[model samples]
Target: MESSVPALPSVLLKDGELKDVEAKPVIIGGMVLDIHATPSVPANPRTTTPGKVHYILGGVARNVAECMSKLGAKPYMISVVGLDMAGNLLLEHWKSAGLSLDVAAESGIPVWFEPVSVVKSKRVVSVVKHITFASPNEDELIAMANALSCGEVFSPIQKDNKKNKCSTESLFQMLRPAIWVLLEEGIKVVVVTLGSDGVLLCSNGAPGFMKGSSKGSNPHGSGNQLYRLVNSSCPPNRFFSASKFEGGSNLFAAHFPALPASVVRLTGAGDCLVGGALACICAGLNVMQSLAVGIAAAKAAVEVDTNVPTEYSLAKITDDAKSIYFATKMMFCQSML
Candidate 1:
């Protein structure tokens, strides 16, 4: 049967002129709203301090799309905003940013806040959810887990039961099942941001094809079916590595620590990571390489107060990430030996 999906646009004009164009769209679905916040100040329980207030576009899905756009990908936003002045302004901003807003519409506003302290710590508190936002409910999550676990949803949940606060294994245990389920559902790739632990990723297969495979080799051959896991370091020096597991692999995992940065704010770091990773993948980079780019994007985001970068070069970031990845890998291996 014929499909309605249109062919991806070519990188040439109809007149046979060479051009650069991206046809693949990264559709981000979630909340959209206007954010108003005061500059960073000392934390006080019962005092009001004078500070400058600023407003900008904010939301999980929206920030992700913005990051993707900055990373040089075509992003389509599927979200709802207030029907008032804020919504109208948001639509204008999206249009100006070159995003496809055909799926965007107007609705009610969802308010959020950003609070920073003298120590430079930040916290975001969500005040409400708009009717039009698309967030997965508990039922859906449970169903996904069940399907992934092959009907083991009701099994006894494992608790970290550890007093140590810096336990990545404990945290990984808590997140592994859900991520595994998503990958099992043919998600291709799943990334989990673990605050202090850095980022963890799961995938069904390596991007592109197995390394060292002969010409005309099947990309999906059994040699590439190993499960993988990686853990990246956190903060001081963001380092990462991966391990491959043998068997009929259903999932692979890896982690990379946060890159060094003078963090101004952490507003939309996670969104930036997701958007960056997706953009790299769409650009034909492997999952591991895409993750490196994601880390670089997030590092750039925290270097400024805004959710997305005002100026960035995707090529430069990709190159920097590759260099850092190789250096970190060398250091990691040396330490292990």
Candidate 2:
């Protein structure tokens, strides 16, 4: 479909007109909400910042869409938002980016609000999104968790449990349909951000985990972290090299399993990481390479305090990871032989 507004220079716009054209805009369908918080930088070693909570649009769809837009990709978002002030801002952000948001559904519910928390030393931040929102029934939640976990263990935190009406299983079920819908669309790449466990990436009919160890800290530069990792790991260049998707690498990587265990910083890092990875893949790299890039992106993100000027090298990260993986493989092979 054609975008209503002009995409960045990298987008493949169909025809000369924006909107309602035959352009193959990348579609990210998900939820949007608002965030309020008091956060501090990990490097500065400061105490928490404080504030009254307010609503703002946030969610994976918006995060990825925004990142892709910045990276010169034509992205359209599909999400659930209410017609409240927060929702209005959500629409505004998309329109300003010249993104296509007409496909988004209005929930009419009170806008989802989150309070963000940040710690400087840990480079961590936590955001409570969907804090008083309605939840789906128990059966649905169970189904979702099952599908999402791929039968592995997925323990939701206690804080999340208090907000929901049913077992953790039920919550996953409720979330699955929305995720499934995005898959139904012709998305070449699908990324599922698994909070602290890392990411579940689906592309070309295969799926697997990036499986970085959890960083036990709050959410922070995760999204940017993921972006850098995926971008750097991309092929030919392999470890760390600059391409179109370098600016937000750290935020992208923040979503990897590495975040919960490594360190924490801000609320939106997961979104940023997801967006960055999407941008890298959209730029045409293979899956493993994309993942390597994502890891590097995240590593870079975790090292800094706030978003700032940064550098990335995907080839270097990939080469290092491969060398490690191969050495381990060789030892195992030698033992077997």
Candidate 3:
């Protein structure tokens, strides 16, 4: 299917009234029961360690939906769950939060795609060219790249080399071909997460295309502060160098360093990053500005035991985002190699 998941828009014209507008985020995917366990102390190989375990709701799409809600967006989610205990718990939370299972659709909103798993990743190749954004971790990016290219896109790497790889420049260089495959296929922006190292954002030179969307905190506040700190337009000067393709198309890319975080569970970091960016994007920030918020959100996820934080501090989110946004030295306009 080209699209079963609906996109997001800030204003929904309702009941044929142009004056009646609502901001609704449409989310589609699974809502899983996430079990978290942390040992209180180091244990011997043959014995069990005293630990804490908790169940949390998790799914790439679901996490993104919930994170957006925390950031103040009414996101209507679509997913399946059983009538069993886990399913009931999941449903109860949705009901309590007022996340919708049924809602009418809208037109002309940004579309974001998530590769739920490596196995299910290839299934979306047919719909790739239509999406506005795709957030894929290393493995999923490889899987989708191979599928999109109709063959292997990344050369095999040694196990040790893969583990020690952290430099954004080096990583982007190795993954350029694979990343380009997606860009040429028509996905507008690619946000690749590098655990602990930071995030790399690549666009077909249109990061500001969504600039006019009405989104964010009281328009006069931090919601629009990050983008104002650094320029998103210009022929890639000090912030980044310009790289032009053979066809003369310009690509804008940037490497945003990860924030210093007190690490905990790493499971939901990437998912929350996507969620944060989506929230800001829906609020009308450009991709560059939205990504800073995404990184800030990931930092919050790591400090907690759950996949998504119970709540996010707008003050902290904005502060951290500004730092990353201003400091991002883009490799966006050129090939690192």
Candidate lDDT scores, in order, read 0.45, 0.34, 0.65
Off by over 4 Å in 3: 1-22, 38-52, 96-108, 156-166, 208-248, 332-337
RMSD of 2: 15.4
Q: Candidate 3 versus the native: TM-score?
A: 0.77
Candidate 3 contains a number of clashing pairs equal to 4
lDDT of 3 by residue, 1-337 (tens): 1122334442321111111133445777778898878799987798889999888898777788888778765667777888899999889887422233223222445567777667787765776745767877677778888999888757633333655764667677777777777887888778787777688788766344423333322242322443332223211123322222222266666788898999988878877887787766555455666788889999999999889998888777878887887788766455322
Best by TM-score: 3
**For model 3, which pairs clash?**
215-283, 216-283, 243-333, 253-332
RMSD of each: 12.8, 15.4, 6.3
Tens-place lDDT digits, model 2, residues 244-318:
222211111111233222444444454445444444444443334444344334444455443311343444444
| TM-scores of all predicted structures | 0.58, 0.39, 0.77
lDDT of 1 at 139: 32
Best by lDDT: 3
lDDT comparison, 1 vs 3, better candidate = 3
